[model samples]
Target: MQPGFDDPVFDSQGVFRSVMFATAYPGRIQTLESPSTAPTPLSRAAAALCLTLADIDTPLWLDEATASSEVIAYLHFHCGARILREPGVAVRFAVLSDLGAMPPLSFFHPGDDAYPDRSTTLVVEVQSLTEGPKRRWTGPGIRGTLEIGIAGMPESFWSDWDLNRELYPRGVDVVFTCDRSVLGLPRTIKVES
Candidate 1:
């Protein structure tokens, strides 16, 4: 695919379909065909997410480190999403460049029982992604089951996740982006340690 300032011939509908499939089947590896060459701190998975979710209605809050002009321009051109600064505000999408330095997962809206889908969906960019030691995943999306060794996440992430999971249908969903791969951790999936 050609990488340029203009938006590539990305199929937003297809990307959304893939995202749905990924969320419906969490812990399963899914790939998105990105249009760009994949820049540092911006993996193909993150790029695909920006394309799929960010539209005129969705406001995106990017980490200070990753909030560059090039990134903003590209996202604007492709997704036409409005960029914001605060995490607790009305943004629907939040991108974290430094996974280690990210704010507690509790910072964003976790939605409510009446409108669970109204919560923010965070796209976390990490240095690497491997099965973590503390937790085991076995839910609707797993084939048999899988072990995930989370890397570069804050110590409080898992605990926060536990609380988020308790919210059931009213919690935020998450996507971990590394290199060219994406992993979904929807609110519906249960995580056991």
Candidate 2:
């Protein structure tokens, strides 16, 4: 089993705050010096997120790339979270090693109208993250508009997101993790080029 937050209380709180900040200020990159450790292809930021948000009650689903025994053991030991085989199941959180290779975005659970907040939250690892190939984000969290760039995404990801955006509160939320940085793209964030 791998080590989790050095100081469980403080570390979880810190990471939680950063995740909240990321969602509150969508498209803004947020960094947290995570005290969590995970298997390869998983970022520290994402590991921290798993430790912070996942618990016995929240079912966690991992992509094939990260469904290894080692990684599963790590998540189990640290978060005591359950892992499910299906992404479309009512999982509270899902972890994917490569966003570019993932299945259709809509394949995951999108909460229904009466319980939109029950949708899944995706934590994806990307090859790199930088600012360029600009995109405009406008939504509840943005003051007006925010321009940002992200790399290592699949070519059709933007189009998929466009369709997901149309679903309003019913779509899954996303968190892109790369190295030590984390960026959020909640269901409320609308993206444009």
lDDT digits (tens) for residues 1-193 of candidate 1: 2253234454556667777887888876677766556445577778778877887888899988778887887788766888988876488889988766788778898877788888999898876667446567876768766777667777688788888888887888898887767778887676777
Return the lDDT, model 1, position 182.
76
By TM-score, how accurate is candidate 1? 0.87
C-alpha lDDT (0 to 100) for residue 150 of candidate 2: 81
Which segments of candidate 1 are over 4 A away from where they belong? 1-10, 131-134
Q: Candidate 1's error at 47, in angstroms?
A: 1.1
State in Å the error of residue 135, model 2: 1.4
